[model samples]
Target: MPDLNPQTVAALLPATCRKVFVAYSGGLDSTVLLDLCVGLPAFAGKIVAVYVDHGLQAESAGWGEHCRRQAERLGVDFELLTVDARASNGESPEAAAREARYRALRQLLAVDDVILLAQHREDQMETLLLQLFRGAGVSGLAGMPIASAFGRGQLLRPLLEVAKVDIQRYAQTHGLHWVEDPSNQSSDFDRNYLRNEILPVLKQRWPALDKTVARSAKHCGDAAQMIEAWAEQTLPTVFDPTDGSFNIADLSAITATQLNCLLRYWLRRMGLKPPSQAVLQTLVEQLVCGRCDATAQVCIQGSIIRKYREKLYCIPEQCLQKEVQTNPWIQEQERIILSNGYVLSRSIASAGLSKNLWNNAEVTVEPRRGGEKLKLPGRAGHHFLKKLYQEAGVPPWERDIRPLIYLDGRLAAVAGLWVAEWAWLSEADGCYQLDWRASESM
Candidate 1:
């Protein structure tokens, strides 16, 4: 490949994107990108350099300062963001740092703003190999796209196809100084191990390994897109938007390969992490063949797959932790924050509970203590909360935190879902309607 220059890099910029922010890590790869952007007429007065300090290494702060000074030397705007990159329960340090870096960059970008990174052909090949080793399907094997919609903006990799040797040559030709992260030399991480040990040997055997591997990744990406299109066609048959769950019977009818594709696509749509193959297979088994009475569940990362009443739910574990404590209701307070991360509010309606009831009775919101029954309007007899939830198709996990509003120590309404017949206003002048807003659902 010809040496990457400012003109070649500028030619790769998308015509629709005017604002550009390069994720300048003060490393060789990013240094080349930053220098190219500084000289590009298209990026003139439209470029900003952002350095994220992951705070993983002791010298991260100093590195950030170096990047800021470099940005100043180039006469470009600069911003620094500090974040904690400590690994969580099931996350690796490298993954943690990467997640934190992108999240910080996202906050600095606006809706149409483009953030550029400096991943080259070799990096792409390494990612493909890593995903293959992990038994990833097409999505992972496809590697990174040049451009994609990201948080509030788009992420672009202008040098994704550029060779690492070309980048190094460009940096040296420009007499630019860049930082060399010590972590890159540490083979303790999987990617570093591949870079330090595996790729060199492979490249010696096959001089064009980077370009060839990239071609294979592109093929995988094409196949992935085709599979995604197929999955989109199958979605309408298996999805139930009414309750935000999948229809087990419909999903079970599909082949295992189809099921796996749909499952990954659905999880991605919901902004949840895709489960590993083992966890996904377990989820499929529970969803398709588990006993009707069984409450089969599989937890992956921070999300949980729950099967209830023949429907599969991708519930965030944080939602389940919202165990609301009993609290008295204040009519004067327009909005009440529930312990379960929901909000209860009072709205006036032409027809609802009698306004007189609000003034005459003291109301409080509390969690159901069990055996609580409500005589809903138009229903023959009072019914237990459990029976009502079951009949209404409410998941068992949600039953515990569902608010039960009381009027003068008597059950008045099942917050926003139903109101007791006794609490119903007669031919009164006005009425007060209860409105509940939960994070996921009522």
Candidate 2:
């Protein structure tokens, strides 16, 4: 409504973008954006409209039809993407629907093709309030970003500065009709509760409530930037992408508060929400202070923090499959009848310390857990596998999931992580048997 010209939108675009993709939901905000894009003279590129059907609402199909008709009327290409909105545990219907909707849109967008969305000032204000209620930190309180990655594409919210009234007015001025979602009026959803109830009360006292909340978000955004800069400086020491895990000792050197902030901050940078403060505290404590006999594990909201070989690893437990196939990379196990009677194939790998090991060791592959010991060639009696791992400088994170190969009942070798002094077989024959393969399984 504030005279949105093609110049404004064009200014935000990259040099490579000649086409704009609008996520046309047939809602008031998107309708206004679509109308403005069609009317604005400065926009020279083609405008493509996309409507995603989450299949959660009964009227979603009808809404899709409406968007298609509107896009056709505006003389633009229209795409309707349908997706299933399966409910995930700890996720509400609204959240799941939204997640599915954007996933569909992201798939449709080309990396260089710009995506214009209608997330206005009110949405920002509501987001700020929601973050506050959820006890979010600076980064979480910073709210939605104006430009961010969506799948392989980038989503640009050009209307972020626009108000709800202005958006509605623009749509009305253009004689645009948008489908109204009834759920928006129901207070059952958190977003609706703010839009209809709390925000109105706040607006009564402070008329420019949305603007005020958005300003707070901007300040939080700046603070988050500062924290990010600090984290960038400190993160390199405790965490490394090359190692694919964190250095536990380096992490332990910091205070609990700093560790909590840095670890959560790091996770957020990876596009994962940080675990709760309680979970993070337990994770750091257990992982850092783990004994040789103890296995430390911390279950966060979306992932699990596990300790192995003195290193800390974050794994998405919810996404992990129950069983893994046998290969060099994964650990597999089964009890098999042998001359020794019921020998377990504790673990397997494609190769080992020496090629001759596979030929002479008669290795059987299987997974092993719970205080397993190994017999090194020079050392007599069984060496506690945990102690051997510690001596080998294996980080705690890697030790938990590290694969070990067992021959008969004695631990023959540790995969990729450590080798038993006794497990090594010296042979004059060329073409040595491989023990640990390049893959993850045995």
Give the per-residue lDDT of model 1 (tens digit) for 312-402: 8877776676445668766688778766567888877776676788778897888877899889888899899999998987888878767
Misplaced by over 4 Å in model 2 are 39-45, 248-256, 268-271, 284-293, 308-310, 316-388, 395-414, 417-442
Provide C-alpha RMSD values for all models, in order. 2.7, 6.5
Model 2 lDDT tens row, 1-442: 3576555566677767667798899999888878777765555447898898888789999999999998988888898888988879988988888888877777776657778888999999998889899998888899878888766668898878777887776677767798899989999899998889888988889999888888888899999889888888888787867544666665546876677777876666544677776766666667766653235667665566666655666665532322122223222223332221212232333433454544445454445465787766667887787787779766554455455555544565665454566566454443223233112220
What TM-score would each prediction reach against the true structure?
0.91, 0.76
- When summed lDDT is taken over every stretch of 10 residues in candidate 1, the lowest stretch is 433-442
What lDDT is reached at residue 193 by model 1?
99
Residue runs of model 1 more than 4 Å from their true location after superposition: 1-3, 11-18, 251-253, 321-324, 425-429, 440-442
